[model samples]
Target: MLSSLALALSCLLIISPNTSAAPNSVPAAGQSIPLIRRAQPERTVAEWESWAKNEREALTAKYGGNIEKRSTGTNLMTNQNADSSYFGTVAIGTPPISFNVILDTGSSDLWVADQACTTGCSKVQLFNDLSSSTFHNLSEPFSIQYGSGAAVGTLGQDVVQMAGFSVPNQIFGAVTQASSGLLNPPVSGLLGLGWQSIASSKASPFWQTLASSGLWTDPVMAFQLTRFVNATNVNTEEPGGSFTMGFLNSSLYTGTIDYQALPTTPSYWILPMKSLTVQGNSITIPSGSSSYSAIDTGTTLVGGPSSIIQSIFAQIPGSQPGTGSWQGYWTYPCGTAVNVAISFGGPSWPISPADFQLTKLTSSQCVGAFFELNTGGSAPNWIIGDTFLKNVYSVFRFTPAAVGFAALSNTAVAMNGVNAPAPSPTIGSVSASATAGTGGGSNAASHRWSVSCASLVGGIVVAVGAAWM
Candidate 1:
C-alpha cells in the first residue's frame, strides 16, 4: 500500500524482484515505472507556513548559514529540507525483499533500514542481508546525518532490482540504528538518483551503475509529477505519474524539448535560469545572485532568493508577508490566480495557479508554494521543486550532461485543470557564466556533511549527527 510522509521530503520507489533478467542484462530499450503521488493531509496556513520556515532554517544551518562557505572548496554535500509527494517501489537481495524508498535526485547514496534497526525503523520494512545469498558485508561504517536524527549502519552489496531492471552487487547502507521518526511505514529508505561525485558513500548511484553496465539505449531519465491539491478526486494516494528510463515518452509531453547545459563540473542537475516573471511582469533578480537552479524532484516547493520571492508575491493584490511562526513566507488572496513563469534559455513555461496555492488561511488568503531561500553568493540561488515541475515534463540526460523541459501534453495538463498557453519557439542558449562561482569550497574531504531530516520528514527542528568510518 502507498503511504505519505507527513512533512517529509523526496520521491519513493517500490521494488519487486525481477529474477528473470540476468544480473547484467539489459531488459528493454525504454522502461517506465508508475509513480504514486502521496497526498499530504490538508493543513492550516499557519502549519504550512511553519513547516516552510523550519525547512529553510534547517537548510541554512546545514550549510553554515552562508552557502558560499560550504562551496568555498569543500565537496558540495547532499542536504534536503522539503516534502515528498511521489513514490514508487524497488527490491534488494537475491530473493529480493521489496521496500518503499524515496527517489531523490538531490542525493547520491542508496540506504535502507537493516533488520537490526529496532528503534525508529520499527514501522518500516528492513533489509535482511543475512537472508540474501549474494549479500556481502563491506565492514565499512555508513551514517546519514538528519535534521533531527541520523541513520547509522554499515556498507554492504547485494542485487537491487527496480522496474524490471537488476544491478548486481550494488553498494548500499544497512542502517542498524536510526533516530525516531526517520523511516516511517511504507517508506523505508532512499534511492539517490544523482552522480557519484556528491554521494557521501562515494559509491555510484543506482542509475549511474545501470548506465555503466550498458543497460539503456539512452542514459537519461524523465519525470512527470502529478498534482492532487485541487483535483476533484482528492484521494490520499493516486497514480502520481510516470518515470521513464532509457528513452523519452512522447505521449507524456508536447511541443519541442528545450535543453540546458549543466555546469563545467556539474554535481547536481543544476543549470542557469534565464528569467522569472509573475502575472506578466518580470521580477528583477538581485545582482550577484548565483542565478543557477537545482532541478530537485525531492523538494516539494520552489525556494529562491528572499527578494525575488517577495517581488513575485507583491504582484498579487492582497498579498501579505506571513508573521510569527509563518515568518519568511507570504500569503495571497485565495481567489487570485497567480500566473508565474520561468525560463532556462528557452521558451518560457508557465506554472498552474492551482499548483502555486499551497494552503488556505482565513478563507481569504492562501499560502504560496514559493518561499524565501538565500543560498549565499556562490551556491545555487534556486531549488526548483515539484511546485514548478508539476507544470511541465522534465528530462535529466547524463550523456551530454544537460537538463531538458517540455510542455506537458493536454492529457497530463487536464489532471490538474491547468490551462496554460502554448510556449513560444525555442531561444538560443543562455550564458552559463552565472554558474561559474558554484561548486567551490574548502577541501573538507575528511569531514562528512550532515542534514536535518527532522525538518524534512516531520515538523520538528532538531540537530543530529553521526560518525563516518
Candidate 2:
C-alpha cells in the first residue's frame, strides 16, 4: 500500500460497543440520537473561543479560512449576538447556554462552556444558565483537548437544528473551559466531523447518538461547502451554506454513486492503494509503508513520504529546481507545465495526469501544489486529492461499516481497482533543485520502479494534456 496523510484540527469521532452503550439507547430509527440524549451541562463563551484560535491556525495554512471574530451588538451577560456568515450560534452544556461555533471538518470534538468551567470559560462568551427552557443536566462530566487547547464540560443534550436536519434532543458539550471558542467566535460551539477527538468530550450526542442507536440507516456522512461572501466574513445566511452528514442533493452528481470497498484504520475510513505508478514506471519505496490513503473532505493537500513523492516527480519533465525550502515548504520553477499520471490499486485502474497535478496557488508558477502535504509528521503515505476525487466517485462508509471507491473514467478499466505495478526505489527527499522528469527508470538498488504508462480504461491514456479538472 502507499502512504497517506490526515489533517483536521477539531477532530471528532464517536464509536462504541453496542453492549457498552448508555442504557437510554433508543432505537435510532425511532428518533434522532441527539434528541434522546442523557443530560446537559453549563458553559462559558470564553472557553470555546480559545479552542477556535489554535484549531484555526492548524487548519488555515493547510486548507483555507479565517478564525478571527467580531462581537455582536451586546456582550455576554445581557444580549446574545451572532452573524450567520462565518459564525454559527448554538447552545452547549447541561443547563445549556449559547456560544459561537465554527462548522469545521478538519477536526472533530464538540465542546462548550460548563458550570465547572472557570478561567477559560469566562474569557469569552458563556451560555447564560437562565435561558433555554429545555435545559437539563446530566451527571457525566467530560474533558477534551487538542494539540494544547483544552475544555472540560458536563454532558447534556440540546435541541440543535441546522440545514433542515434537526435533533430535537441533540447532545451539547457544555464545556466549563472551552478554548476553541474564546474570543473570535464569542458565539456558541463547534460541530466536529473530522478524525480526531478529546477522548470523549461531548454532551450533544450528535452523530454518535444517531449511529449508535441505529437511528440512521447509513453510517456515512458527507459535507458540501459553498464558499460565499457577505456583509461580514461570515458563511451564515448564504444561499449555498455549508451542509453536513448528508449528500448534496444536486443534478450534477445524479447517477449510480459507486462505492469503493473500504477498510478500517483505527479512526477514519481508508482506501487501500497497492502501489503508485507514474508514467510507465512503478515508483518504488520502502516496504511496510502506509498501504492506504484516506479520503478526507476536510483536507486539501495530499501529504506523503518524501522519497515516494520524488519518485513521481521524476516523471514531470522540467518540474525540478524547486528543491529549496521556503519556511519548510518546497518552491519550484515559476512556470513549469504540471502534468503526470498517478495510478493506485494495481495497473488496471490509473489516475490521469490531470488528477495528479494542481493549479498554481499564486500568479507565479504553481508546481506540485495539489500533492503538497506536510509529511513532517510520523507517517509515510500520500493523499489522493482533487486530482483523484474530481474524476472518481468516492464514498467513505463510516466505521464498522464497509467503505468503497469506484472510477467514472468512462473507460473499460474504469472500474478496475488498479492493476499491480512494479515497485521503485527511494531516491531522496523531495527538493526544489531536482526537476520533474529528471530521473529515468534506472535504480541504484535491487528494487526497481515500473511505470503504468498506458491505460485502456478511458481509451485516452494520460499521454499529456492541457490543465483539466
Candidate 3:
C-alpha cells in the first residue's frame, strides 16, 4: 500500500468491524476500511516543491518506459495532474451512485465521469448508466493514455461499493472522452491497485472481485500514509491511515514483516533494490542489471535512474541541479542534515530526511524528494513514491506474490534501535510565509475531521481495473 508519515499527511478511514456489518452484506474477511488520505494541498515547502516538480515531470513523461507495455485490452494510468493524488468514496450503480474515486496503485482501469463529460470534465460525480437499475451495458471500447491526459470509455456492469464492501456485477468505466487531468481537483475516477496484469479492461481489479467473490478472506492490501506536520498538524482523532482489505493489521505494525519475493514480470509491486544511502554511505548505481524497485502507491515522487538520480544528488549537502520548473530536480539546501537510506534485501531502511525534504524554496532553497526517472532502457527502475512510503509498514500480499515491510505506528520500536531520532524537521518555519492556495474540492473537511469516513457500502458500484496476466 504506502507510507512515509509526515508532510501534511491526512487519510484515515479505519474500519475495524469484525462482525456487525450487514445492511447490504459483505464485510466478513477481517473487516478493515479507511479512507481520508490527503497531502498535496497545504503547500509552503516552496509550494509543495513546485507541485512536486510538476508531478515528477508528469510521471516521467507518462509512466517512464516499459510501464508494463500494455496491449492486451488497452492500457491506462494517464494523468494530467492531481497533485499528490489520493481520494476515496466508492458507491456506483444499482440504487447507489456515490463517486470520488482515484486510489491507483499505478494504473489499472475503473472509471467515472460520464454523462458524456463536458470538455476537460471535472464538474464531478457522473456515471448515469441510464439511471442504474443494476446497469450492465458492456459495449466495451475503453481507452486510457496519460502523461497529461486521456480517457475514452464504454465498458459497464455496476453495483460496486466500499467499506462495508459489496461487489455485485462490478466491471467499470464510463467516461466518454476525458482529460482535464481528470477534472483536477479531489479526484473523480481511478482505483487500480495494479496487477490484474495492467488492466485495460482485462478485468479483475475491484479487490480482485472481492478476493474471488468469497468476500475477501485475504488477498491482502495494506498501506499507512499519514505525515502531516503543518497547517496545524492534527495527529489523530482516530483513523490516520489505512486501506487494509482482506486482513493483516497486527495492530497496524511494528517489526518482523520484511518479506519480499515478487516479480510476476512488471506487474508493479516490484522489489530487489539493495542500495542508495547518503549519510550512512552507500550510493552505487553503475547498473548493468539487478537494481529494481517499484513499491509505488501510485507514485507522487521518488522515481529514479537519471544516472541514479545523479548519483544520489551527488551525496547531498548543498545539492543542486534543478532550474526552470525544477529541471531535473535534486535541489536541496533548506535545512539540510540528510540521512536517507533504502536497501530492501536485508538491513538499512531508514529514509526520513523528513521524508527526503522538499518544499521551502527561498530562505535558502529546499526540494529533494529525488526525481529524475527516464529508465526506458529498463533495469534501473525505482519509483518508490510517498516519499519513501511514509516511513514503511506496507504489505500487498496476494497469496505469496509478496511485498512487506514494517516500522511505523510510533516508530516501530525506535526503528529497531540503533540511534533513530533523525526524521525530525517535519517542516516548520522556513519563515512559514504561505501563498500557495488553490486547494479547491475533495478533502471534504478531512473526511469528518478526526476520523470516520463512514463506509459500509450499502450503495454498491465497484468498477475496479488492471488486467494483463
Worst 10 residues of 3 by lDDT: 443-452
List the candidate 3 regions with Cα displacement exceeding 4 Å.
Answer: 1-111, 121-128, 135-157, 160-166, 169-179, 183-188, 192-214, 221-276, 279-296, 303-321, 331-346, 349-394, 397-443, 446-469
* C-alpha TM-score for every candidate: 0.70, 0.47, 0.30
Error of 3 at 145 (Å): 21
The TM-score between candidate 3 and the true structure equals 0.30
- Which structure is stronger by TM-score: 1 or 2? 1
Error of 3 at 231 (Å): 42
lDDT of candidate 1 over 1-469, digit per residue (tens):
4346632222323233442445555545233234335998999999999899779878998887842211000011111221235555667887778776656676667889898887778877889988999998887888765323567788888877666556676778888887765564556787777777776677767777655544555667888766766755344345556666566778879988898888646577787778889999998774323777878775567777788888899899999987755566689999899999998878888998987887776688888878776553344677787788888899888788889999999776664523222112111121100111112122213122232111431132211111101
Better of 2 and 3 by lDDT: 3
Model with the higher TM-score, candidate 2 or 3 = 2
Candidate 3 lDDT over residue span 1-469, tens digit each: 4555542142323454443444666644445443335785565989889889678767876876322111101011112121243345567776776675656666656778788877656566678888888887877677665333467767787777665565566677777777544444444677677666556666666765555444454567677655542213232221224566666667657667887777555466778787768887788854324577767665555766678788787887678876655666667787676788887776677877765765556788777767665543332366676667767878777666778888776633232212212221111111111111111111111100011111111121111111100
lDDT of 2 at 327: 19
Least well predicted 10-residue stretch by lDDT in candidate 1: 69-78
Q: Residue 144 error for model 1, in Å? A: 2.6
Q: If both were scored by lDDT, which would come out higher, candidate 1 or candidate 2? A: 1
